[model samples]
Target: MKDGLKQRLVAQARAEGFDACRLCRPWDVRHVPERLAAFLARGYHGQMGWLEERSQWRGAPEVLWPQARTVIMLGESYTPECDPLAGLEQKTSGNISVYARNRDYHDTVKKRLKRLARWLIDAAGGEVKVFVDTAPVPEKPLGQAAGLGWQGKHTNLVSRELGSWFFLGSVFTTLDIETDPAEVDHCGSCRACLDICPTKAFPAPYQLDARRCISYLTIEHKGPVAEELRPGLGNRIYGCDDCLAVCPWNKFAVAAREVKYHARADLVVPKLADLAGLDDAAFRERFSGSPIKRIGRDRFLRNVLYAIGNSGEGALCHVAQAHCEDADAAVADAARWAVLRLRRDANGLE
Candidate 1:
């Protein structure tokens, strides 16, 4: 009966658009508590203080739900149709990470998780819970324990079959299901991900310092990005994909099956000049359904100004100067920074 239910759950998961599905016991991620404590102790989470706020539930799934006997991990692939690094070549444009180039995965994955949980409850008469990335839930570690993939050096799950271009969703249920063996790390000698980080965010092979990470510094971080790290960000206005794109394991990745994740041509290599001009209303309208919308207009423009500064185009200097007195101090500061950098480059000081 347990075996049959597991197969049915996998079928339902794929039917609902998940590309991969696997199972694990609730207590499978045994080392997470101490690992998380160490990471927080080092202040590696940066401005994401929420990770510390919910450490107990995130650190232990069994403690999160003692009644839960099985965890169903799902992977939704969003592999970019082109080289994810292609935007970096077009310095005039901003590099929005492939993950944020479409509708927010939090909304997409949540509905699917709810659908699966409902089915599980009806079939086996057990309670269930669903989680996407927003929760303090340690989805990556649980993903590894579920035989979905191993946590690569970049600290994100990398699947041999799905590569690094996927999102994770989990369904925890009171129903016990047959468990799959955990995946073992395959990142032996390859430093592809570690070497690709522009900000040297990785402290070691499998450790990361979120303070210097472009993704966190751009999105989760408040205020202007640290001046020292701004240049390394280049034109990556949203999240950074350098490490994910450089993974050799992604050679096996296929095109994204979900039509919603297909890149909007306008968003693919959006001109930095155009983005810098977006006011609050225009920003909301432009990024209506995008993951980028959550950062709000001020923070988004702050990132745009930083990119404009790094552009060296100098042609964008006036655009930066125009925003030098933006209503938001961070935006104004970023604008001033961009103006200075561009003016410096104009004077051949760059």
Candidate 2:
């Protein structure tokens, strides 16, 4: 009866549009503590202090919700129809991460997880909790334990069917469900992701130093980006996708079926000039329901200015120069730096 009900739940997850569904016993992720400790010990997380504060709950799911007997892991693909790397050639254009190019996944994935959780409660009569990235849960390890996928060398979950372009969400329930066997790592001598990192953020396979990660530097780090690393960031205004884009498994990735996740035309290759001019109000209005809003106008402009500097197009020099007087020091400094870079590149400064 337990195995039959688990199968039905997995089928329901697929019918509800989740790309894949798998189960793990709540206790399965308990061994993550040692790995988490090592990651922290190496200072890999950088200034993201929250990862340190939530260490206990992050490594052990049972610590967060003891009543949970099973965890249902779900994957939803957000692969773009076009090659996400194509924009990198256009030095003047900003490269937003493929995932952030559409509506925020937090809201979209959370709503679906809630619907699935409610159905489970109604069917089995049990308490449940749902988590996206917002929680302290060690989602990647949990996903692996559930047999959804193994964590690739880049530390993101990669699946045989959907690759690494999918977002993960989990539903924890008190109902005892049969757990699935864990997926084994298939990376196998493949160093494509590591070699492709522009920022060299990965210290070694399976370990990431967030301090040098473009995603963390641009999105999580509050102050100025490290000087030496700024140029390598290029036109990437948001998170970096170079690592994920080069993965060989992505050949199987299908375009997202959910229309809401489809990339917005405006966001695909936004005009750097327009992005640099956004004030707080304009930024909020433009990025409504988008993940880009979380970084706010100042940081967004800072990133844009960095891209403008790297663009090597003299046309955007004026745009960067205008922001040199922005109210935000970070934006203003970035703008001033961009202006200098543009002038140097144009004039062939000695």
Candidate 3:
């Protein structure tokens, strides 16, 4: 009976736009506690204090909700239609991460998760709870346990079918659904993802030091970035995709079917001059439905100024100069740094 229900659940998930759906027991990710401990002990999470604060719940799904018998992990592909790395060469344009170039995944994925959860409760007579990235749930580990994909060397879920470009969502239910076998690492002898990282975020294969990760630095980080790492940020203003785009597995990556995940024309490779000029109101209005809005104008401008600093275009130096006295300390710091770099470059000094 549960098997039939699981089959229908997978079908319903596909109908609702999920690229992959598989089930696993809530306790399937038994290694999470120790791994989470090691990561936190090393201070790899950076400014994401929530990860440390909710360590117990994040490491143990069973402990998070003891009543959950099955965890249905779903993957929604958001693969870029064009080369994600191409924008890096256009130094005058800011390279927004492919994921943030469109609608916010949190809203889009959660709506699907909620609909799937409601269907499960109606069909199987079980209480259900759903989560996207906002939750403390170890969605990637659960995705691996459910055979949705293996956590590749870059520490992001990579599937044989969907490759490296997908979002994870999960539905935890009281129903005792049969589980899928976990995926094993297929990344043997491949270091493509690690080799491409501009900031060298990976401390070793299969482990990430989020402190050096551009994604964490650009998005989660609150203040001015370390001077040494600023150069590695290059023209990446929002989030970096060097590791993900370099994955060989992405050769087989599934194209995102949802229009919402497609990159907007203006956001694909926006000019640094245009972005550096946006004030609070303009920034919010421009990024209304984008994940970039979460970072707010100050942080966003900080990133843009960093990009402007890296941009060798001396014409943009004045844009940085304009923000040198920004109300936000981080923005002012970034602006000063940008102006200094551009001045040094203009004078042919290192």
Candidate 4:
């Protein structure tokens, strides 16, 4: 009966829009505690202090919910239709990461998880809990344990089938489902992800320093970024996809099945001048259902100012000067830096 149920669960997961569905025991990620400790010890997490606060539950899924007998890891594909790196060349436009081009994945993935969990409860008597990156659950390690994919050198999961373009979600249940064999690493000395990093965020293979990562700086971080790292930011205003975009395995990736993951017309190449003009209300309205909204206007403007500074377009100096006295200290500092950089560029100070 459990075997039959597992088969149907896989079918249901596919029907619910998940590209991969596999199961594992809750305690499968044994190496996580040591690795996570090392990452935190080295201060690699940067401003994401919440990672340190929930160490116990994050390190051990068994302790997060002791009654769970199976962990079902799900992967939803959000592959892009075009090269994500193309926008970096558009100096006057703000480049957003491919994943945030449309609606927030958390809201979309969680709703699917709830429906799948309900179906499981109806088919078999068991309690279930769903997580879509909102909890202390170690989804990536658990995904590898469930045979979904190996965690690549970039520290994000990579599937031979899905490439590096999928989001992970999980359902933890009390039913004793059979677990799949863990996936072995297939990175095999490929350095594409490491070489493409503008900020050298990776110290070594399978390791990442979030402090120097543009995604961490533009999103998770607060205050003015370190000036030394500003030039590497380029025109990216929200998140960076350098490591993910350069993976050689992406040749196998297909276009996303969900239309909501596709790039929106305005977002594909948003003008830096237009973005810089957005006030708080305009910012909120513009990014209404998008993940970029979480950063707020002041922080978003700070990122935009940094991008303008790196653009080498003297024309944007006026935009930067307008924000020189912004109420937010970080934003003001970023504006001043941008003005100086643009003026220096105009004076041939390179």
Candidate 5:
């Protein structure tokens, strides 16, 4: 009966548009506490202090819900039809991460996880709880234990069939679903992801130092990006995908089938000058339902100014100069820095 129910759940997950579905015992991830501790001890999480606050519960899923006998892990692919790295070559344009280019995945993935959890509970007469990235759960490790994928050297889950261009969600349930065998690390002898990082965020093959991660600096880090590191960020406005894009396993990957996951044409390569003009209200209106809205206007503009500075286009000097007097100190500082960069580019100075 448990095997039959597990099979039904997998089929339903596929029918609902998830790329893959797998099950594992909730206690399967209990062994991850040591690595979790190591990561936290090294302060690799950067300003995401929440990782430290929730470390105890995050490393052990069973602690999160003592009654959960099984965990259903699902993966949703968000691969774009075209290479996401293409915009990086265009210095005047900003490259937004493919994940943030569409409607936020939290809403889309959560709704699906909730619907699936409800269905499982109703069909199997058990209790369940669903979670997306917002939860304290260590999703990547859990995904690994559930056989969805192995934790790649980039520290993101990578599947043999789906590659790394996927989002994960979990459903903890009291149902006794049969477990799938965990996937083995297939990244042996491959350091492509580690070497591809523009900011050199990876300190070791499988370890990431978020402080140096462009994604963290551009999106998560609240203060001024270190002056030395800003150049490596290039024009990436939000999250960095260089590591994911360079993974060889992605060759077999398919573009996202869900229309909601499709990249917005305007977001693909937004003009830095146009983005720098947005105020808080304008930013909210433009990014409504998009992940970029979470960072709010000031931080978003700070990123835009960084891109403008790197653009090396004197034509963008006016935009940078305008933001130099922005009310937000961070934006103003970034704008001032951009003006200097533009000036230096134009007149070959120290």
Candidate 6:
């Protein structure tokens, strides 16, 4: 009976737009707490204070809800239609990560997880609670614990079929579902994801220093980027995809079938000047449904200014100059730094 119910859960998940699903006991990720403790001790999480605050709940899913007997891990692919790294050469334009190029996955994936959860409750008669990345759950480790995928060296889940281009979701339930075999690491000796990081964010083979990650710097970070790391950003105005795009496993990744995951024409490679022109109102309107909107106008411009400083296109100096006195001090600071960098390039300084 448990086996039959678990199979039905997987089928329902796939039918609701999830690419993969697997079951695990709530306490399956035994080693995650230790790894997280070490990571937090090293202060690798940076300003994400909440990760530390919710360490108790994040460290033990069973402790989070003792009554929940099982966890159903789900993965949904949002693989880019074309090469994500190709935007790097288009230096005059901004490069947003492939994940953010489409509609926010949190909402899209959660809706499906909810549908699956509702089905599980109705058919199997169990209480359920769902979580996407919005929670402090150790999803990558849990995903591995449930056989969804292994946590690659980049610390993102990588599967034989989905590579690194997927989002994870979870349904915690009171049902005693049959668990799947845990996935084992298959990264071998390859370090493509680690080496491709422009900021060298990896402290070791599989460890990441979030402070140096471009994705963190451009999004969660609230102020001017550390001056030394700004040039490493290239023209990436949002999250960086270098690590994920360089993974060898991506050869197995097929393009995403969901229409919402398709890139909008303007966002594929937006002109730096055009992006820099966005005022607060325009920024909100332009990014209404985008994950980029969460950072708000000031943080968004701060990232764009960093990209401008890195562009080497002296013509954009005037665009940066216009924002030198921006209301947000961090944005103004970024503008001043960008103008200085572009001016130095104009003067033939190496």
On TM-score, the stronger of 1 and 4 is 4
Model 4 CA deviation exceeding 4 Å by range: 1-3
Write one digit per residue (lDDT tens) for candidate 6, span 204-226: 98899999999999988877788
Residue-wise C-alpha lDDT for candidate 1, range 2-66, written one tens digit per residue:
44887888898989989999999989988999999999999999888889999999999998889
Q: When superposed on Cα atoms, how far off is each prediction in RMSD?
A: 1.0, 1.2, 0.9, 0.7, 1.1, 1.0
Could you say which candidate leads in lDDT? 4
* Model 3 C-alpha lDDT per residue in residues 269-319, reported as the tens digit of each score: 999999998988999999999999999999999999999999999999999
Clash-forming residue pairs, model 5: none
Give a tens-digit lDDT track for model 4, residues 1-350: 45599999999999999999999999999999999999999999998999999988899999999999999999999999999999999999999999999999999999999999999999987999999998999999999999999999999999988999999999999999888999999999899999999999999999999999999999999998998999999999999999999998888886799888998988997999999999999999999999999989999999999999999999999999999999999999999999999999999997
Model 5, span 13-84: residue lDDT tens: 988889899888878876688997898899998899998898878888898899999889999999888888
Model 3 — TM-score against the truth?
A: 0.99
Order candidates by lDDT, high to low: 4, 3, 1, 6, 2, 5
Whole-model lDDT per candidate: 0.92, 0.90, 0.93, 0.94, 0.89, 0.91
- For model 1 the local lDDT of residue 50 reads 89
State every prediction's TM-score relative to the real structure. 0.98, 0.97, 0.99, 0.99, 0.98, 0.98
Error of 6 at 155 (Å): 0.9
List ranges where model 1 is wrong by over 4 Å. none
Query: How many backbone overlaps does candidate 4 show?
Result: 0
